[model samples]
Target: MRKSAAPFLLALALPLAALAQAPVQYSLAFPNAVHHEARITVVFAEVPAAGPLQVRMARSSPGRYALHEFAKNVYDVQATDSKGQPLTVTRPDSYGWDVSGHDGTVRFTYTLFGDRTDGTYAGIDQRHAHLNMPATLAYARGLEQRPAEVKFELPTDWQVATQLRPDANGTYYAPHLQYLMDSPTSLGAQQRRTWQTLGRTIEMSVLHEGTAAELDAYVEQSKKVVQEAAAIFGGLPEYDFGRYTFVANYLPQTSSDGMEHRNSTSLTSNRPLRGAGALDNLGTVAHEFFHSWNVERIRPRDLEPFDFERANMSNSLWFAEGFTQYYGELLLRRAGIYTDEQYCQEALNGLVGAMLNSPGAARFSPVQMSQQAPFVDAAAAIDPNNRGNTYLSYYYIGGANALALDLELRQNHKTTLDAYMRAVWQQHGQTQRTYAPANPYTLTDLQRILGEVSKDTAFAGRFFRQHLLGHELPKFDQLLAPAGLLVRRAKAGQASLVARLSFNPADSTATVGSTLVGSPLYQAGLDREDVVRKIDGQRLTSAKALPELLAAHKPGDVLTVEYRTRGGIRTAPVTLAEDPTLEVVTYETARRPVTRAMKKFRAEWLSGKAKSFYPKPQPEDKDVSG
Candidate 1:
């Protein structure tokens, strides 16, 4: 028996080696790219002798809260066994196909029709194939924990751009299904720039119809953004494969969008790397890069295990997305892309104005508003809803709160939001397990960390209760005072209906787009689609007529208004009110005195926090690796 032990050991080792080599394999080929179609094949091997295997396309992509039903684009699906023999396949649901009699191995193939180029959908053309993984690939149900490998049979002279770790055999690897779904790939003739910082490789792959010189110049600008973003959190996150990627597609055929992933970002725009469009596009760069830390790593618990089966709802997007929105523009200022006056006028002014004037902010707290993301975060429907009147984007609400909280921390606690962010990174985002975050944060964790950073539990509790859970906004005028920024009424002493109106010259009627709640128009029972025939007995002949009528009156003045509703023409006595819009301007711009204290406050708040770490990128350092 001892002499024959070798044969027994060989039998056990055979299946172990087979299991080790059995990964969910996926191969993509664009045979009909001109028609926006890709042929995809997935191989599931060593299936543990399971009776049936369920394969399906993801319903929703990451960084999106809506259910997109990606299965709608998949067709011509077929399956086979290990020996290339036909397997019996049955449609169990709209999204999945069940395969039986697979002999412990199943090969699934399908055709994916994709036409849109954005962060949430797949786009294919003669020029390139932009693929969001969840939209392009299918996965086997019980094989989620197995390693996944992707091989792209690219077009001539085309290469792949993705965060997926690559092997010498031209195959990309993901630890598991979660990482596989989050990786988006861009296949094209890409121009890329690579650099090393903090012992990590950072790559920017741009697929555009631009010159090499233009890409080099844009790389310089983007370098500044990356450095400034890293400074806020002390350094770059420890990337899984010791690399991070920016997959950008700036072409006329692509849609404008920026989506965040764990180790990379998808930046797409219909703008080129020339003129004002370049800087405008860079704004999205700062935003999605910041998300690598905020939403991708310092994640909300509601989104920790992102579900691909249905709509993913979260109540902390105000902090996840809104705070990131705040830093998106702020980081530009710190990087010197925006002057102080420009930052105050554009970013600060917009945030304060929306929070001050929006009826949604007044009606819903940040938490409540964030819960509405599943309905409004790019969700589509034919019938209209009252989102215009009831929704204030969590981005603006959270940004305004960040502005206030940052000031409060600086003035009262002698700390900065930067410090609190570092604390959050250390506690929740710094530690990681290969593919996902190990300590993704929760709402309670955010409050607790704020308390720890500020050394004031009571202040943190009060702030969260008042601004986050309650619909109470901080006084922006007072918060901006120390920094010598002014928050004042834009149109003081002027009467306004405070509603957006579209004038139709054909009928000489003004259509009310959406009436702000609590505004004069809202008080007068005017809503969306109502046609205003006259104001103060004057015909609304053009866009200027309503402003002229408002100018002739003052706040608290009553005027006769005639309008058309679904019930027909109606008349009401409308009491006009002062325009509630707010604006932010530096004290210097406002012709107010800027003292030494104000200068110090502004410098501390706006200046760059870290030294430059990247060397000047050279044109010769271009990397075209897929």
Candidate 2:
């Protein structure tokens, strides 16, 4: 038999080594940003002899519950031995490859095209490199739990900002691939700042296409948001990681998105942090930072060990994502980003936005919608489909549910959702529960917590069955009344002809987006993607003119909608129907005055200065360093 080509095969096949002696290593270099590509190399210092080595691209990222097929961006892949000699690599599947004839050490060299910037995608240009870990790197099949090290050979002016802790020698290390996957790295001319609170450290790094003063101001206000947000969960989770980072990329080329991570977040936007639009950007900061406790730690059991090879669908995202959406804006209000009226407007928007997807809500429950993440969450739009007609986002449905539950808890239980969240925190979060995934909660577990907090198991069960697991919407009118708010119609209550018939506005050409199952739009023979050739003797060239003409009509008004089907142009008469709109009106008139009780309730629930519910930051936290 020929002697082995490389040594240390047994060591890699064994259990994970100490970080200092990790057998897996990665090096990334961005040499030619003009080409919009990065060269990535992975070296396995040791290899299993009995089996072929498999390398794979993640099917989905951590926070993004949707399938992104990150492999689609990977190409020019090749394998080599420890001495850089070529190895035989075979295609296993679209997302994976099998390598054989490798020395004890096998290395993979590939070029990845990444020119989109967001929290969940990879974007690289002469300006900067915004990378989501899953989108930028690949991993060995069985080395997900193996210790590894990552090195970035960046441009001279570029500084690397990532959540991965660095060793004394300046090399970033990951205890495992899972930890690595949760850490995103942005390499560019970043302005970095640091602050300390309650013995925990916060490091903010911003890479923007604006003046440095703007970034400085954004960081200053972000520190305040962090302070006010701590009150929601009583205090921050045990920041045993020693530090947390907030990585922001607000370049003109970056797509607007925000993704929560283990110790940091990837927040990108088209607007600079210095503009008048900066306040809106702060909401993304507040939202992702809160996830440091809620979803990241008090995670759904179904999503405990996130799948990297297939679409991971969870049924409890109604709470995981929806409750987070509810609190994201609520915390913004508490942080003074929104006025009393603005906050109420946001709540009203949430209610209406959810109901607009009513055709979907009418068929599926919040839980069902959450499970539809694979199809909707960050899902690419293919040809026209029924998503609009039957695909309400859990963000809306779940937020609406949260609004209802919060009011119920306040009115009936004399408790608030704040108490419930804190209780959940004490039980599931606190003490750095994010690192070691254990004691994850299920849908039933969440209901139990709610029942205990409300002191009514019946109410919790009913809420889950009807509002979460069933299609019944909450009674928003009753829920908002105690808080001096009630639903109002922004438009006439007359029936609508196409409230469910959506359109694409780019020179619309009478195209239909979706027709809800039972809407008059669906009954009018206007199917998805059908184009209207004429309606009531008018040659419809665009979608703009019909809405104005329809506004003058009401229910029982008969009209003809001539459109093109798959076969050819067709004509059908449609009866005008109701105007669908949801708005919340405050009790303001002198006759129906905003009552003292309602004012008190609203103040306590929305505007009043919250009592100091958390301990002050420690005295030793006077100095901050990064």
Candidate 3:
């Protein structure tokens, strides 16, 4: 029998023995002490021989729009083999590390100081807290897509929460390497709130110095958001999912914004909750929560197999970022957080704001803007001409386009964008398929999906090409007209007069940008850069009321004005002329009720259930690194 022992048996036995001898995977230690200071340590099974090892942080986290050098935060890195011997390590790039020499079991530890305005880490100094997630966590480069385990060691009293899969022992398990790298961990002295809806338990963790009453109100609003959003999605993704954490840093210097995460979002704002109302909080929560489905799960192809070393560009951000932006407010309205009037006003504000800012309304494409966003530095300093001529943020122009598309889709078929998204969810979300997997979802796939739901391939294709892919903005008024909503100038009769002054080429004093061609101001001889000091009895802070005051009088009305021209203070008398076209409005009448298709479309559009089909969550066994 000994002489007959097979070579195959011995080979199998040897491999099995090696596998059994491998050390039980342990945990990842992330220490949070100072708000801007932290450390990460990964302890793993020992390797018998030295092998090359690399670690990296993502170039940009899922929720953050700008490209961030997350790797810059890492410092004082060290690695030790199972025998407690130091291994040689070198940084291959700004975002990654390379290790050489033999190893059995190894532990990699590094101190990460995430204190900076333009880098990976963000700190809210006034609240004395920080939110560090995937942006600050590092993965073993190529191994990012593989299965790994993590454990957190935080400040004794601090609460830690994340969307990563958690094991029985509180160790977070990444089904594969990629999931571990993509999911972020949040740690701080934040107040946590928990709720249940649609057969799922949800949590809202907040970090603020505000009183408990204020925090409780925020939590209640968060629960309503989750409930409303879940109803729209059909159901929550997991029956026992982690809580949605809101890291609120009451930093007096912070602006109004929040970044989304897989299971949590960090919001920075100084606005008091009192006058803000539920609508405001609901909108904010909806925007970030929806990202879990859009950018987080069903991501752009380029974002998959992410390049942690540099920016990854994609033309599909219009769909990911812009479409979500459109849905954010719409969902709030559908959830009854805002009335129809409020929703319309918000939409109008976005549209008018975009149009009034630049003359390049029809020039830029969403895809081009998304691809080049990494190079556009400051948000405030962005030139409308530059955005108009070269780039257009999906958040603004693209969002407007999505709104039109939603309305158009409703008018064409009885189905709405909600159903289209649901079809996407059923097809991709349930199937866990990528846009172009080996079995990809192509343009044909999209067309077929839309056809199945709406029975209108022609309409879907036309909309996608003409508005989404093409540079042209739709006539939004046309889409809304069928619904009884009018897009028109705010008239003196319906609204108060508000004059806006435009600066001349010299960039000195404010002047008239445009006078509506036949406006009363034009007839009143109010030339550009007149710089009026007073109008009738009232001193003029701006030229806004000039037209209103003129419109108040008859065709033969006379008005007196004092102004500063190139010659300083002066006076002039001007006759007001009648405006034949005083106002142009787009509104709906009771005679034409919303069509059946339009009604269905509105229901589906307001509900976000349609997007559920794409980017289905991976199976429990699959790694999330991708």
> Residues 1-626, candidate 2, lDDT per residue (tens digit)?
11220122322345434343444789999887877899999998667677788888887999887788899999999999988899998888888788998877889989989999998889998889999989989888656657778898888999988888887776787777778999999999988888886557888888877776777778767876787667777666665367888988888888988899878989899987755568778878988898888788888888867777667889988887888888888877776777766776765666654654378887899998999998888888766566766778888888888888899999998899988988887776664432754577788888899899999999989988888889887777788888887676656555466553445456445666667666665887678778765666775444566776676677778888778889887888887767656666677621367889999998788762333654443454333543
Candidate 3 Cα outliers beyond 4 Å, as residue runs? 1-35, 44-51, 64-66, 116-129, 168-170, 239-255, 277-279, 352-361, 376-385, 433-444, 491-626
By the lDDT metric, which is better: model 1 or model 2?
A: 1
Q: Which stretches of candidate 1 lie over 4 Å from their true place?
A: 1-21, 612-626
TM-score of each: 0.93, 0.91, 0.71
Ranking by lDDT: 1, 2, 3
Residue 319 in candidate 2, Cα distance off native in Å: 0.7
Check candidate 1 and list the clashing pairs. Answer: none
lDDT of 1 by residue, 1-626 (tens): 33222332333334433436578999999989999999999999888674688787888878999889899999998999989999999988888898998899999999999999999999999999999999999987656667899999987889999999999988999977789999999999988888766566789999998888888888877877888888788788889888889999998999999999988999999899978888888889999999999989888888877877778889899999999999999988998888998898769988999998887888799999999988888889899788766789999999999989999999999999989988998999888775677888889999999999999999999999999999997898899999999988889999988888999899888999878778888999988999989887888777788888788889999998899999999999999899888889899988999999999999999987645333453343233442
Q: How many pairs collide in each candidate, listed in order?
A: 0, 5, 36
Q: Report the Cα lDDT for candidate 3.
A: 0.55
Best candidate (score: lDDT): 1
The local lDDT score (0 to 100) that residue 567 gets in candidate 3 is: 69
